[model samples]
Target: MKLQLLSDLHLETEAFEPEPAPGADLLVLAGDIDATWQGLERFAGWPVPVLFVPGNHEFDGRAVEHVVPALRGLCTRLGIRLLHRESWLFDAADGQRVRFLGAVRWSDFDVFGARERERSMRAAGYFMRLMASTQHGQPFDADAVRREGLACRAWLEAALAEPAAGRWQQTVVVTHFAPSLKSADPRFGRQPGTASFCNADDDLIPHTDVWLHGHLHCRHDYLVARAGRKPTRVLSQARGLVDKGEAEGLDPGKLIEL
Candidate 1:
């Protein structure tokens, strides 16, 4: 099936213009879907099935009580499937099958960097608190960085091990973070790779396929070797609304028949 993948559309409701483009079957919004939940309505009204995941922007690192409910409502209204630490199998146009395992990966400093150790620690704590801040913390330590990794890893492993695994013509991994190590470009600037950004998890190595993510707006496209030891395409389409110049480098509103 023809699918359109986009991310980081820090939504501007007044000027939002996303055409489904003719022949597009499914739409995948990797993350940073919008600047706020207010944009959800318009996104939901799109005439197609959308699969989305939350990006760091979607989280205030406070409580999901705000975003989760709104997202669920939007999904219900728009017929979109929001996956997080979950998997979904989709049928493409050519009878091919694709599975999406979604997650907002934690920063992997071991590979990315140790520069923002203090900030990473704080952010990690905030994330953990947000995860567990609900209930009497019934879920217990929802904010733990280790737990987040485990959850995402568990879901991916299970999805890859499905009994019908070999039945899929090809698989696509939809995540909020980059999955390949090859995307690691430490050659860039002042303190290149100093930001502790772009996470790459060990769990990702095995399920390598197409990693559709949107965290780095400048770093952009990358391809890495994984699983079948083949090139796994990675795309991060996070240009903000004002990026008219950058838009020229992208082919939006087109269906990628993979």
Candidate 2:
């Protein structure tokens, strides 16, 4: 199936403009659809099926409960599925079976030997507290880092397990953040202390065919090998097909065949 991917669209009604490629079978909004409902309304008129996910900005510094339903309803009206730590299996128009796993995943680098265990632990603790604070209606806390990371791992385990029955399964993992430092922005300029793409390790499962992410605006194309077998394609459409120095808007007008 052909898919057009876009992400990190921090739209404020007036500034949001997406002119996606024409005639795409599917459009995937990787995350951060927008900080307010304005962005959702802007995309309401899109012609094809859309799959959207929540990003850090989508939360608008609020709890998930507060914003999810609104976005979900908007997506429902537009025939889009808002995936968050969720999975879906369906057949394409040509009868090709496709499975999608979406998560605002946490970086798992330390466990994967991609980063220092101490650093991973520190980030984990911070993520856990963040999640907790959001749940309790309290201000942001660094401790939620671990909670978010562990939750993402748990969600992915379940999401990836379902397609094991098929010999020729196509799995796409969509997230707001990249899984490793290999694809991180070069602005850090080789600093050891700089966090990787997702600030953690990424474990690409055997069935994964593509990994789509955003958050690092300056990054564009990347590839990674998982398990020394099938090649996994990693793509970010922060500015679509526009080159790094271009003055184009965030919504790049490219259509990707998935």
Candidate 3:
């Protein structure tokens, strides 16, 4: 299967009109295509099957309680599959099957170390200020985000362990947040603020074949070692803030073969 990967189009401020690339078996939008949810309509009736995973931006200014239900309804109406803590199977042209597990995977603020969680929390206040999402009839707080992130991690761990998911020809994990610190930009390496952008999901690398994510507004394509298994390929194809042309290593026509 040749899957075209794209993310972080941020169509809220940037202009983009994309069609499924020729010969692509699937089009995967890793998230942040738009926060307002209107940009997603552009993919309606796309030539190939389109799978989307909502990024943090999708909830900004919207109540956390309402953001997902609204997206789910829109996706159902548009024929797009929105995956979050969800699984979807794709039948490849070669008669192979690929299974995808997706989530926004919010940062746990434990990227540095368990001991430094407090420091990471202190350094990152931007999410609360900007997300502006409400939960439990109150503003969503860091603790809530942290709990949700960990819950995603737990769900993924259990999902990957399922025999049914493992029976596919290949397994792929998708998220809006970086799976490992290695996917982070080197310039911000080890910074407390960087904790908000990625996760300490090194433990999960050995459990899956491929991982796709978008959050840092950059790009990455690297292989991570997996014990007694094929090396896991980590990729990000985010377009970032195109108006500023800051998204590095972006390949809009990039395709991954499974």
Candidate 4:
């Protein structure tokens, strides 16, 4: 299937909007299309089917408990599929079957190392809380993200472990926070703040056909896998912050064949 991916557009800025790639079978919005979640309305009558997974930005300025239900209502009304700890199956006209699993996959702050975890939690947590979101009527802090991220990781792992008794040809995992450090921009690889954007799930890379992520404001395409396993693609096409030059490499019209 030919698929197009777009994320981190941050349309709340109102400075940019993406042009859809012609002939694309589906469009995957990885996350952060807008902090207000209003930009999604623009795609209400999108030419092709759309799949979305919420990013951290989606919860900004709102109670975490309230965002999902509101998103569900909006997505339902707009005909967009909102994926949150869920899997969706798509059958290509030629009979190929692909399963997509999506979630926020907030970082556990374990991107560095075990020794630095405590420090990562303290640092990454501060960075995340800067979004000023609340959960269950309280600040949604790092510990909250870690709990959620760990659960999401486990859910994806379990889903991938399912037997292919049914006949799906491939699995695609999508999340706002990246699953592996290899997905992070090299220049900021070891930074504590960067740890908030990825997790230590590199081992999971080889288990899926393709992994797409957002949260970083740059574009990337790379291969990752287990020690002796076949490589899988880990890609990101995030149109990140405009002022910091992080959005420099995005190709608004790029598409990938799955």
Best by lDDT: 3
Q: lDDT per residue, candidate 3, 1-258, as tens digits?
A: 888989889899887777678889999999999888899989998988999999988998878878788999999999999999999888888898899999999889998889999888877677778888888688777777888899999999998888863568888999999999998876668788888889999898778889999888778889998767778999988887755665655668888876
Q: For candidate 3, give the lDDT of residue 81.
A: 92
Which pairs of residues collide in model 4? none
After superposing candidate 1, which stretches have Cα over 4 Å from the reference? 12-14, 113-147, 161-163, 180-196, 226-230, 241-248
Model 4, C-alpha of 7: deviation from truth (Å): 0.7
Model 3, runs deviating above 4 Å:
164-166
Mind giving the per-residue lDDT tens digits that candidate 4 earns over 171-243? Answer: 8999998887777777677788788888988877788989999988778899875567567889898988889
RMSD of each: 4.7, 4.3, 1.5, 1.6
Model 2: CA > 4 A from native: 106-133, 189-201, 226-229, 240-251
Ranking by lDDT: 3, 4, 2, 1
Per candidate, the number of residue pairs that clash is 4, 16, 0, 0
Ranking by TM-score: 3, 4, 2, 1
After aligning candidate 3 to the native by TM-score, how far in Å is the CA of 73 from where it should be?
Answer: 0.4
User: Which stretch of 10 consecutive residues in model 1 shows the poorest summed lDDT?
Assistant: 188-197
Backbone clash tally (model 4): 0
CA-RMSD of model 3: 1.5
* Tens digits of lDDT, candidate 1, 183-219: 4434433232323345545445545567777655533
What lDDT would candidate 4 get against the real structure?
Answer: 0.85
Cα error of candidate 3 at position 217, Å? 1.0
Candidate 3 TM-score versus the reference: 0.95
Residue 148, candidate 4: alpha-carbon lDDT: 85
Write one digit per residue (lDDT tens) for candidate 2, span 147-234: 5656887887777766457743588888887666666666554343333235443565444788888866654666666666667787
